[model samples]
Target: MDIPYTSKPRPDTGLYNAKVGIWLFLASEVMLFGALFSSYILLRVGALEENWPHGLLNIPIGTFNTAVLIISSVTVVMAWASLKMKQFGRFKIFQAITVLCALAFLGIKSFEYKDKFTHYEVWKTDGTRMTGHIEGNPMFLTKAKLVAAGKDKIEFLADPHHYSEGKLKIGAQSGEHKHVEIAIGDIKRLSAFVPAHSTYFAIYFTLTALHALHVLGGAIVIGFLFGPGSKMWHTDPDRFTNRVEVAGLFWHFVDLVWIFLFPVLYLL
Candidate 1:
Protein backbone atom coordinates (compact mmCIF):
# COMPACT_ATOMS: atom_id res chain seq x y z
CA MET A 1 0.00 0.00 0.00
CA ASP A 2 1.27 3.52 -0.85
CA ILE A 3 0.61 6.58 1.32
CA PRO A 4 -0.92 9.65 -0.24
CA TYR A 5 1.23 12.82 -0.24
CA THR A 6 0.04 16.43 -0.10
CA SER A 7 1.91 19.49 -1.39
CA LYS A 8 1.99 22.73 0.64
CA PRO A 9 0.32 25.81 -0.86
CA ARG A 10 2.60 28.48 -2.24
CA PRO A 11 2.73 31.96 -0.75
CA ASP A 12 0.51 34.50 -2.44
CA THR A 13 1.57 37.99 -3.53
CA GLY A 14 -1.68 39.77 -2.75
CA LEU A 15 -2.85 42.67 -4.93
CA TYR A 16 -2.21 45.03 -2.04
CA ASN A 17 1.36 43.80 -1.59
CA ALA A 18 2.14 44.18 -5.30
CA LYS A 19 0.86 47.73 -5.45
CA VAL A 20 2.21 48.69 -2.02
CA GLY A 21 5.66 47.39 -2.81
CA ILE A 22 6.00 49.61 -5.85
CA TRP A 23 4.71 52.63 -3.93
CA LEU A 24 7.00 51.96 -1.00
CA PHE A 25 10.00 51.69 -3.27
CA LEU A 26 9.06 54.93 -4.97
CA ALA A 27 8.63 56.67 -1.63
CA SER A 28 12.10 55.64 -0.56
CA GLU A 29 13.55 56.89 -3.84
CA VAL A 30 11.72 60.16 -3.32
CA MET A 31 13.25 60.56 0.11
CA LEU A 32 16.71 59.94 -1.30
CA PHE A 33 16.35 62.48 -4.09
CA GLY A 34 14.54 64.86 -1.79
CA ALA A 35 17.59 64.95 0.44
CA LEU A 36 19.88 65.69 -2.48
CA PHE A 37 17.65 68.44 -3.83
CA SER A 38 17.19 69.95 -0.40
CA SER A 39 20.93 70.07 0.05
CA TYR A 40 21.24 71.80 -3.30
CA ILE A 41 18.63 74.37 -2.36
CA LEU A 42 20.28 75.10 0.93
CA LEU A 43 23.83 75.42 -0.35
CA ARG A 44 23.11 77.43 -3.49
CA VAL A 45 20.57 79.70 -1.87
CA GLY A 46 22.81 80.32 1.10
CA ALA A 47 25.87 81.05 -1.03
CA LEU A 48 24.11 83.53 -3.27
CA GLU A 49 22.15 85.01 -0.36
CA GLU A 50 18.85 84.67 -2.27
CA ASN A 51 19.81 83.99 -5.88
CA TRP A 52 19.58 80.55 -7.53
CA PRO A 53 21.13 79.03 -10.65
CA HIS A 54 18.09 78.78 -12.90
CA GLY A 55 19.49 81.19 -15.47
CA LEU A 56 22.53 78.99 -16.02
CA LEU A 57 20.48 75.97 -17.10
CA ASN A 58 19.57 75.59 -20.76
CA ILE A 59 15.79 75.49 -20.72
CA PRO A 60 15.34 74.64 -24.40
CA ILE A 61 17.57 71.56 -24.34
CA GLY A 62 16.02 70.38 -21.12
CA THR A 63 12.53 70.88 -22.51
CA PHE A 64 13.42 68.82 -25.57
CA ASN A 65 14.76 66.02 -23.39
CA THR A 66 11.55 66.16 -21.37
CA ALA A 67 9.57 65.61 -24.55
CA VAL A 68 11.77 62.68 -25.53
CA LEU A 69 11.25 60.91 -22.22
CA ILE A 70 7.50 61.54 -22.38
CA ILE A 71 7.33 60.02 -25.86
CA SER A 72 9.43 57.06 -24.72
CA SER A 73 6.96 56.43 -21.92
CA VAL A 74 4.16 56.28 -24.49
CA THR A 75 6.10 53.83 -26.64
CA VAL A 76 6.68 51.64 -23.59
CA VAL A 77 2.92 51.47 -23.07
CA MET A 78 2.44 50.53 -26.70
CA ALA A 79 4.97 47.76 -26.33
CA TRP A 80 3.10 46.37 -23.32
CA ALA A 81 -0.20 46.54 -25.21
CA SER A 82 1.32 44.65 -28.10
CA LEU A 83 2.51 41.93 -25.78
CA LYS A 84 -0.89 41.70 -24.10
CA MET A 85 -2.58 41.25 -27.47
CA LYS A 86 -0.13 38.44 -28.30
CA GLN A 87 1.25 40.44 -31.21
CA PHE A 88 4.89 39.55 -30.66
CA GLY A 89 6.05 41.12 -33.91
CA ARG A 90 4.43 44.45 -33.13
CA PHE A 91 5.64 44.17 -29.58
CA LYS A 92 9.21 43.89 -30.81
CA ILE A 93 8.73 46.93 -33.02
CA PHE A 94 7.48 49.05 -30.16
CA GLN A 95 10.21 47.80 -27.87
CA ALA A 96 12.82 48.78 -30.44
CA ILE A 97 11.29 52.22 -30.77
CA THR A 98 11.38 52.68 -27.03
CA VAL A 99 15.06 51.76 -27.00
CA LEU A 100 15.77 54.26 -29.75
CA CYS A 101 14.04 56.99 -27.78
CA ALA A 102 16.14 56.15 -24.74
CA LEU A 103 19.27 56.40 -26.86
CA ALA A 104 18.16 59.75 -28.23
CA PHE A 105 17.60 61.04 -24.71
CA LEU A 106 21.19 60.14 -23.82
CA GLY A 107 22.49 61.81 -26.97
CA ILE A 108 20.74 65.05 -26.11
CA LYS A 109 22.04 64.80 -22.56
CA SER A 110 25.57 64.44 -23.94
CA PHE A 111 25.18 67.69 -25.82
CA GLU A 112 24.03 69.47 -22.69
CA TYR A 113 26.99 68.14 -20.74
CA LYS A 114 29.31 69.22 -23.52
CA ASP A 115 27.91 72.71 -23.38
CA LYS A 116 28.57 72.90 -19.66
CA PHE A 117 32.16 71.70 -20.06
CA THR A 118 32.78 74.10 -22.91
CA HIS A 119 31.56 77.05 -20.89
CA TYR A 120 33.88 76.06 -18.03
CA GLU A 121 30.86 76.06 -15.75
CA VAL A 122 31.94 72.84 -14.04
CA TRP A 123 33.02 73.31 -10.43
CA LYS A 124 35.07 71.65 -7.71
CA THR A 125 34.47 71.84 -3.97
CA ASP A 126 37.74 73.61 -3.19
CA GLY A 127 37.71 77.45 -2.99
CA THR A 128 41.13 77.94 -4.58
CA ARG A 129 40.39 76.52 -8.04
CA MET A 130 37.58 77.36 -10.49
CA THR A 131 37.12 77.76 -14.22
CA GLY A 132 35.00 80.11 -16.31
CA HIS A 133 34.81 83.74 -15.34
CA ILE A 134 31.29 85.15 -15.11
CA GLU A 135 32.09 87.57 -17.97
CA GLY A 136 32.64 85.08 -20.80
CA ASN A 137 29.20 85.48 -22.38
CA PRO A 138 28.95 88.55 -24.66
CA MET A 139 25.21 88.68 -24.15
CA PHE A 140 25.84 90.03 -20.68
CA LEU A 141 27.97 92.81 -22.18
CA THR A 142 25.15 93.77 -24.51
CA LYS A 143 22.69 93.79 -21.62
CA ALA A 144 25.05 95.99 -19.61
CA LYS A 145 25.27 98.40 -22.50
CA LEU A 146 21.53 98.48 -22.78
CA VAL A 147 21.24 99.07 -19.05
CA ALA A 148 23.75 101.96 -19.29
CA ALA A 149 21.66 103.45 -22.12
CA GLY A 150 18.82 103.96 -19.65
CA LYS A 151 17.39 100.44 -19.45
CA ASP A 152 15.47 100.86 -16.19
CA LYS A 153 15.04 97.19 -15.37
CA ILE A 154 18.72 96.41 -15.91
CA GLU A 155 19.82 99.36 -13.79
CA PHE A 156 17.41 98.20 -11.13
CA LEU A 157 18.46 94.53 -11.09
CA ALA A 158 22.21 94.49 -11.67
CA ASP A 159 23.07 98.10 -11.02
CA PRO A 160 26.76 98.85 -11.41
CA HIS A 161 26.54 100.90 -8.25
CA HIS A 162 25.55 97.84 -6.22
CA TYR A 163 27.88 95.41 -8.01
CA SER A 164 30.80 97.80 -7.81
CA GLU A 165 31.17 97.52 -4.06
CA GLY A 166 30.97 93.71 -4.21
CA LYS A 167 33.20 93.55 -7.26
CA LEU A 168 35.88 95.68 -5.65
CA LYS A 169 35.88 93.54 -2.56
CA ILE A 170 36.28 90.39 -4.62
CA GLY A 171 38.94 91.98 -6.78
CA ALA A 172 40.93 93.24 -3.79
CA GLN A 173 40.89 89.86 -2.07
CA SER A 174 41.66 87.84 -5.20
CA GLY A 175 44.05 90.50 -6.62
CA GLU A 176 42.01 90.44 -9.85
CA HIS A 177 41.28 94.12 -10.31
CA LYS A 178 38.71 94.50 -13.06
CA HIS A 179 36.90 97.77 -13.76
CA VAL A 180 33.13 97.84 -13.44
CA GLU A 181 31.94 98.68 -16.93
CA ILE A 182 28.26 97.82 -17.24
CA ALA A 183 27.85 96.90 -20.90
CA ILE A 184 24.19 97.22 -21.92
CA GLY A 185 24.10 93.75 -23.54
CA ASP A 186 26.11 91.92 -20.86
CA ILE A 187 23.15 91.46 -18.54
CA LYS A 188 21.93 88.53 -20.64
CA ARG A 189 25.21 86.69 -20.04
CA LEU A 190 25.12 87.06 -16.29
CA SER A 191 24.94 83.64 -14.57
CA ALA A 192 25.41 82.52 -11.02
CA PHE A 193 28.72 80.88 -10.28
CA VAL A 194 29.29 77.27 -9.27
CA PRO A 195 31.89 77.09 -6.53
CA ALA A 196 34.91 74.85 -6.92
CA HIS A 197 34.40 71.36 -5.49
CA SER A 198 30.99 72.39 -4.26
CA THR A 199 28.53 69.88 -2.87
CA TYR A 200 25.85 71.28 -5.16
CA PHE A 201 27.75 70.24 -8.25
CA ALA A 202 28.35 66.80 -6.77
CA ILE A 203 24.64 66.32 -6.14
CA TYR A 204 23.78 67.53 -9.62
CA PHE A 205 26.21 65.14 -11.23
CA THR A 206 25.21 62.17 -9.08
CA LEU A 207 21.46 62.53 -9.55
CA THR A 208 21.67 62.93 -13.31
CA ALA A 209 24.16 60.10 -13.59
CA LEU A 210 21.95 57.76 -11.57
CA HIS A 211 18.95 58.58 -13.77
CA ALA A 212 21.00 57.86 -16.88
CA LEU A 213 22.06 54.55 -15.36
CA HIS A 214 18.44 53.55 -14.96
CA VAL A 215 17.82 54.22 -18.61
CA LEU A 216 20.83 52.11 -19.50
CA GLY A 217 19.58 49.27 -17.29
CA GLY A 218 16.16 49.40 -18.94
CA ALA A 219 17.75 49.22 -22.37
CA ILE A 220 19.82 46.19 -21.34
CA VAL A 221 16.76 44.36 -20.08
CA ILE A 222 14.87 45.05 -23.29
CA GLY A 223 17.78 43.83 -25.35
CA PHE A 224 18.04 40.60 -23.38
CA LEU A 225 14.38 39.79 -23.95
CA PHE A 226 14.83 39.97 -27.68
CA GLY A 227 18.35 38.58 -27.90
CA PRO A 228 19.67 35.04 -28.47
CA GLY A 229 19.30 33.91 -24.86
CA SER A 230 15.58 34.69 -24.88
CA LYS A 231 14.55 31.28 -26.17
CA MET A 232 13.50 30.03 -22.72
CA TRP A 233 10.95 32.80 -22.30
CA HIS A 234 10.04 33.01 -26.00
CA THR A 235 8.65 29.49 -25.94
CA ASP A 236 6.17 30.56 -23.25
CA PRO A 237 4.42 33.74 -24.33
CA ASP A 238 2.49 34.16 -21.07
CA ARG A 239 5.62 34.11 -18.96
CA PHE A 240 7.42 36.31 -21.46
CA THR A 241 4.59 38.82 -21.36
CA ASN A 242 4.73 39.04 -17.59
CA ARG A 243 8.47 39.69 -17.85
CA VAL A 244 7.80 42.56 -20.25
CA GLU A 245 5.21 43.96 -17.88
CA VAL A 246 7.74 43.99 -15.05
CA ALA A 247 10.31 45.69 -17.25
CA GLY A 248 7.74 48.27 -18.26
CA LEU A 249 7.11 49.01 -14.61
CA PHE A 250 10.80 49.80 -14.12
CA TRP A 251 10.90 51.95 -17.25
CA HIS A 252 7.90 53.92 -16.06
CA PHE A 253 9.60 54.51 -12.74
CA VAL A 254 12.62 56.02 -14.51
CA ASP A 255 10.35 58.29 -16.52
CA LEU A 256 8.50 59.35 -13.40
CA VAL A 257 11.75 60.31 -11.69
CA TRP A 258 12.63 62.58 -14.60
CA ILE A 259 9.21 64.24 -14.40
CA PHE A 260 9.99 65.33 -10.88
CA LEU A 261 13.66 66.09 -11.58
CA PHE A 262 12.91 68.27 -14.60
CA PRO A 263 11.04 70.80 -12.52
CA VAL A 264 13.40 70.68 -9.57
CA LEU A 265 16.61 70.96 -11.57
CA TYR A 266 15.63 72.90 -14.69
CA LEU A 267 12.49 74.81 -13.88
CA LEU A 268 13.15 75.78 -10.29
Candidate 2:
Protein backbone atom coordinates (compact mmCIF):
# COMPACT_ATOMS: atom_id res chain seq x y z
CA MET A 1 0.00 0.00 0.00
CA ASP A 2 1.17 3.56 -0.70
CA ILE A 3 2.13 5.79 2.26
CA PRO A 4 -0.66 8.01 3.49
CA TYR A 5 0.01 11.74 3.99
CA THR A 6 3.10 11.65 1.81
CA SER A 7 1.91 14.74 0.02
CA LYS A 8 -1.22 15.55 1.98
CA PRO A 9 -1.55 16.95 5.50
CA ARG A 10 -3.04 14.91 8.30
CA PRO A 11 -6.27 16.35 9.76
CA ASP A 12 -5.17 16.51 13.41
CA THR A 13 -1.71 18.08 12.90
CA GLY A 14 -2.26 19.80 9.52
CA LEU A 15 1.29 18.64 8.63
CA TYR A 16 2.41 15.91 6.31
CA ASN A 17 3.87 12.75 7.86
CA ALA A 18 7.46 13.77 7.04
CA LYS A 19 7.05 17.28 8.39
CA VAL A 20 5.65 16.04 11.69
CA GLY A 21 8.40 13.47 11.88
CA ILE A 22 11.16 16.06 11.22
CA TRP A 23 9.80 18.38 13.91
CA LEU A 24 9.95 15.55 16.43
CA PHE A 25 13.46 14.72 15.32
CA LEU A 26 14.52 18.36 15.67
CA ALA A 27 13.11 18.45 19.20
CA SER A 28 15.44 15.63 20.18
CA GLU A 29 18.36 17.43 18.54
CA VAL A 30 17.64 20.50 20.62
CA MET A 31 17.84 18.50 23.82
CA LEU A 32 21.11 16.84 22.81
CA PHE A 33 22.91 20.09 22.03
CA GLY A 34 21.32 21.74 25.01
CA ALA A 35 22.96 19.34 27.45
CA LEU A 36 26.38 19.89 25.91
CA PHE A 37 25.99 23.65 26.03
CA SER A 38 25.08 23.47 29.69
CA SER A 39 28.18 21.45 30.34
CA TYR A 40 30.29 24.13 28.68
CA ILE A 41 28.85 26.85 30.95
CA LEU A 42 29.44 24.81 34.08
CA LEU A 43 33.02 24.06 33.17
CA ARG A 44 33.78 27.66 32.34
CA VAL A 45 32.28 28.96 35.56
CA GLY A 46 34.15 26.50 37.77
CA ALA A 47 37.59 26.95 36.24
CA LEU A 48 40.23 29.17 37.82
CA GLU A 49 40.05 32.76 36.59
CA GLU A 50 43.57 32.89 35.13
CA ASN A 51 43.59 29.33 33.79
CA TRP A 52 40.93 29.66 31.11
CA PRO A 53 42.27 30.48 27.66
CA HIS A 54 40.78 33.25 25.57
CA GLY A 55 41.55 34.98 22.31
CA LEU A 56 43.19 31.76 21.15
CA LEU A 57 40.76 30.82 18.37
CA ASN A 58 41.05 32.45 14.95
CA ILE A 59 38.09 34.81 15.09
CA PRO A 60 38.51 35.97 11.52
CA ILE A 61 38.21 32.43 10.21
CA GLY A 62 35.28 31.79 12.54
CA THR A 63 33.50 34.86 11.19
CA PHE A 64 34.03 33.71 7.62
CA ASN A 65 32.57 30.28 8.35
CA THR A 66 29.58 31.97 9.98
CA ALA A 67 28.93 33.83 6.75
CA VAL A 68 29.24 30.61 4.75
CA LEU A 69 26.54 28.87 6.85
CA ILE A 70 24.29 31.93 6.61
CA ILE A 71 24.62 31.87 2.83
CA SER A 72 23.66 28.20 2.75
CA SER A 73 20.62 29.02 4.86
CA VAL A 74 19.47 31.56 2.30
CA THR A 75 20.16 29.29 -0.64
CA VAL A 76 18.27 26.37 0.94
CA VAL A 77 15.20 28.56 1.37
CA MET A 78 15.43 29.66 -2.23
CA ALA A 79 15.78 26.07 -3.36
CA TRP A 80 12.57 25.07 -1.62
CA ALA A 81 10.78 28.09 -3.05
CA SER A 82 11.99 27.22 -6.52
CA LEU A 83 10.42 23.78 -6.21
CA LYS A 84 7.18 25.38 -5.06
CA MET A 85 7.17 27.52 -8.20
CA LYS A 86 7.82 24.46 -10.41
CA GLN A 87 11.14 25.94 -11.61
CA PHE A 88 13.24 22.80 -11.60
CA GLY A 89 16.27 24.49 -13.19
CA ARG A 90 16.38 27.22 -10.56
CA PHE A 91 15.96 24.62 -7.84
CA LYS A 92 18.98 22.77 -9.10
CA ILE A 93 21.16 25.90 -9.12
CA PHE A 94 20.13 26.93 -5.59
CA GLN A 95 20.55 23.45 -4.13
CA ALA A 96 24.00 23.15 -5.68
CA ILE A 97 25.10 26.39 -4.00
CA THR A 98 23.84 25.14 -0.63
CA VAL A 99 25.93 22.00 -0.91
CA LEU A 100 28.98 24.00 -1.95
CA CYS A 101 28.63 26.25 1.09
CA ALA A 102 28.46 23.24 3.38
CA LEU A 103 31.70 21.94 1.87
CA ALA A 104 33.43 25.30 2.23
CA PHE A 105 32.49 25.45 5.90
CA LEU A 106 33.82 21.95 6.53
CA GLY A 107 37.07 22.64 4.68
CA ILE A 108 37.76 25.72 6.76
CA LYS A 109 36.99 23.83 9.98
CA SER A 110 39.50 21.12 9.11
CA PHE A 111 42.14 23.77 8.52
CA GLU A 112 41.45 25.25 11.94
CA TYR A 113 41.78 21.85 13.60
CA LYS A 114 45.13 21.27 11.91
CA ASP A 115 46.36 24.61 13.17
CA LYS A 116 45.40 23.71 16.75
CA PHE A 117 47.23 20.40 16.68
CA THR A 118 50.43 22.07 15.51
CA HIS A 119 50.22 24.91 18.00
CA TYR A 120 51.69 24.49 21.50
CA GLU A 121 51.75 25.97 25.00
CA VAL A 122 54.84 25.66 27.17
CA TRP A 123 55.39 26.24 30.88
CA LYS A 124 58.97 26.94 31.88
CA THR A 125 60.56 26.00 35.19
CA ASP A 126 61.02 29.73 35.71
CA GLY A 127 57.28 30.04 36.36
CA THR A 128 56.20 31.44 33.01
CA ARG A 129 53.82 30.17 30.33
CA MET A 130 53.54 31.07 26.64
CA THR A 131 51.68 29.83 23.60
CA GLY A 132 52.45 29.85 19.89
CA HIS A 133 53.81 27.79 17.03
CA ILE A 134 56.98 25.77 17.57
CA GLU A 135 59.54 25.98 14.84
CA GLY A 136 59.19 23.24 12.15
CA ASN A 137 55.43 23.10 12.88
CA PRO A 138 55.37 19.74 14.57
CA MET A 139 52.11 18.11 15.73
CA PHE A 140 51.69 17.29 19.44
CA LEU A 141 55.35 17.68 20.21
CA THR A 142 56.40 17.31 23.84
CA LYS A 143 59.44 17.91 26.08
CA ALA A 144 60.27 14.21 25.94
CA LYS A 145 60.38 14.33 22.15
CA LEU A 146 62.76 17.28 22.25
CA VAL A 147 64.99 15.52 24.78
CA ALA A 148 64.85 12.28 22.79
CA ALA A 149 65.96 14.18 19.70
CA GLY A 150 68.81 15.65 21.78
CA LYS A 151 67.67 19.16 20.95
CA ASP A 152 69.07 21.84 23.30
CA LYS A 153 66.66 24.58 22.39
CA ILE A 154 63.37 25.04 20.51
CA GLU A 155 62.72 28.15 18.41
CA PHE A 156 59.15 29.36 18.80
CA LEU A 157 57.08 32.17 17.36
CA ALA A 158 55.26 33.32 20.47
CA ASP A 159 52.21 35.47 21.11
CA PRO A 160 53.20 38.59 23.11
CA HIS A 161 50.27 38.64 25.51
CA HIS A 162 49.45 35.66 27.72
CA TYR A 163 46.19 33.95 26.77
CA SER A 164 44.53 35.21 30.01
CA GLU A 165 45.11 38.85 29.15
CA GLY A 166 41.39 39.19 28.35
CA LYS A 167 42.43 41.27 25.38
CA LEU A 168 38.69 41.47 24.81
CA LYS A 169 39.67 42.32 21.34
CA ILE A 170 39.34 41.03 17.78
CA GLY A 171 41.58 41.43 14.72
CA ALA A 172 44.33 42.96 16.84
CA GLN A 173 46.69 40.10 16.06
CA SER A 174 48.72 41.97 13.50
CA GLY A 175 51.99 42.98 15.29
CA GLU A 176 51.92 41.46 18.75
CA HIS A 177 53.95 38.31 18.16
CA LYS A 178 57.66 37.55 18.44
CA HIS A 179 60.19 34.74 18.08
CA VAL A 180 62.03 33.23 21.07
CA GLU A 181 64.29 30.34 21.96
CA ILE A 182 63.39 27.99 24.83
CA ALA A 183 65.86 25.56 26.40
CA ILE A 184 64.67 22.01 26.93
CA GLY A 185 66.12 21.86 30.46
CA ASP A 186 63.88 24.78 31.55
CA ILE A 187 60.71 23.38 30.04
CA LYS A 188 58.23 22.27 32.72
CA ARG A 189 55.46 20.97 30.48
CA LEU A 190 54.30 21.17 26.87
CA SER A 191 50.94 20.50 25.27
CA ALA A 192 48.89 21.21 22.15
CA PHE A 193 45.37 22.64 22.27
CA VAL A 194 43.73 19.23 22.42
CA PRO A 195 40.98 18.42 24.95
CA ALA A 196 43.52 17.08 27.46
CA HIS A 197 45.09 20.53 27.61
CA SER A 198 42.29 21.90 29.79
CA THR A 199 38.55 21.90 30.52
CA TYR A 200 37.97 24.83 28.15
CA PHE A 201 39.45 22.97 25.22
CA ALA A 202 37.63 19.79 26.19
CA ILE A 203 34.25 21.47 25.74
CA TYR A 204 35.42 23.39 22.71
CA PHE A 205 36.30 20.26 20.72
CA THR A 206 33.25 18.34 21.93
CA LEU A 207 30.77 21.04 20.88
CA THR A 208 32.32 21.95 17.53
CA ALA A 209 32.90 18.35 16.48
CA LEU A 210 29.29 17.42 17.24
CA HIS A 211 28.04 20.41 15.29
CA ALA A 212 30.27 19.51 12.35
CA LEU A 213 28.76 16.02 12.23
CA HIS A 214 25.29 17.55 11.99
CA VAL A 215 26.42 19.70 9.09
CA LEU A 216 27.81 16.66 7.29
CA GLY A 217 24.62 14.65 7.86
CA GLY A 218 22.34 17.44 6.65
CA ALA A 219 24.52 18.03 3.58
CA ILE A 220 24.40 14.33 2.67
CA VAL A 221 20.60 14.21 2.82
CA ILE A 222 20.20 17.43 0.86
CA GLY A 223 22.83 16.38 -1.64
CA PHE A 224 20.98 13.11 -2.23
CA LEU A 225 17.81 15.05 -3.00
CA PHE A 226 19.77 17.21 -5.42
CA GLY A 227 20.98 14.13 -7.28
CA PRO A 228 19.37 10.67 -7.70
CA GLY A 229 16.52 11.53 -5.34
CA SER A 230 15.40 14.28 -7.72
CA LYS A 231 13.80 11.49 -9.73
CA MET A 232 10.95 11.67 -7.26
CA TRP A 233 10.18 15.13 -8.57
CA HIS A 234 9.36 13.67 -12.00
CA THR A 235 7.27 10.73 -10.75
CA ASP A 236 5.56 12.51 -7.87
CA PRO A 237 6.19 16.25 -7.81
CA ASP A 238 4.14 17.08 -4.72
CA ARG A 239 5.79 14.38 -2.62
CA PHE A 240 9.19 15.59 -3.74
CA THR A 241 8.40 19.15 -2.74
CA ASN A 242 7.35 18.00 0.72
CA ARG A 243 10.66 16.16 1.03
CA VAL A 244 12.60 19.33 0.21
CA GLU A 245 10.64 21.29 2.82
CA VAL A 246 11.48 18.73 5.49
CA ALA A 247 15.17 18.80 4.58
CA GLY A 248 15.15 22.57 4.61
CA LEU A 249 13.82 22.61 8.16
CA PHE A 250 16.72 20.47 9.36
CA TRP A 251 19.25 22.62 7.50
CA HIS A 252 17.93 25.75 9.19
CA PHE A 253 18.44 24.11 12.60
CA VAL A 254 22.04 23.26 11.73
CA ASP A 255 22.63 26.87 10.73
CA LEU A 256 21.04 28.18 13.93
CA VAL A 257 23.30 26.06 16.14
CA TRP A 258 26.39 27.56 14.51
CA ILE A 259 25.06 31.05 15.13
CA PHE A 260 25.09 30.35 18.88
CA LEU A 261 28.36 28.42 18.69
CA PHE A 262 30.43 31.16 17.04
CA PRO A 263 30.16 33.72 19.84
CA VAL A 264 30.20 31.25 22.71
CA LEU A 265 33.32 29.43 21.58
CA TYR A 266 35.23 32.21 19.82
CA LEU A 267 34.26 35.55 21.33
CA LEU A 268 33.31 35.03 25.00
Which ten residues in a row are the worst by lDDT in model 1?
155-164
Model 1 CA lDDT for position 94? 82
lDDT of 1 at 7: 18
Candidate 2 lDDT at 50 equals 79
Clashes (backbone N, CA, C under 3 Å), per candidate, total: 26, 0
* TM, every model: 0.63, 0.94
Report lDDT (CA) for all predictions.
0.60, 0.92
Residue ranges of candidate 1 with Cα displaced over 4 Å: 1-11, 15-28, 44-51, 121-199
lDDT of 2 by residue, 133-201 (tens): 998899978888889999999999987777776645323665577899888998999898988788888
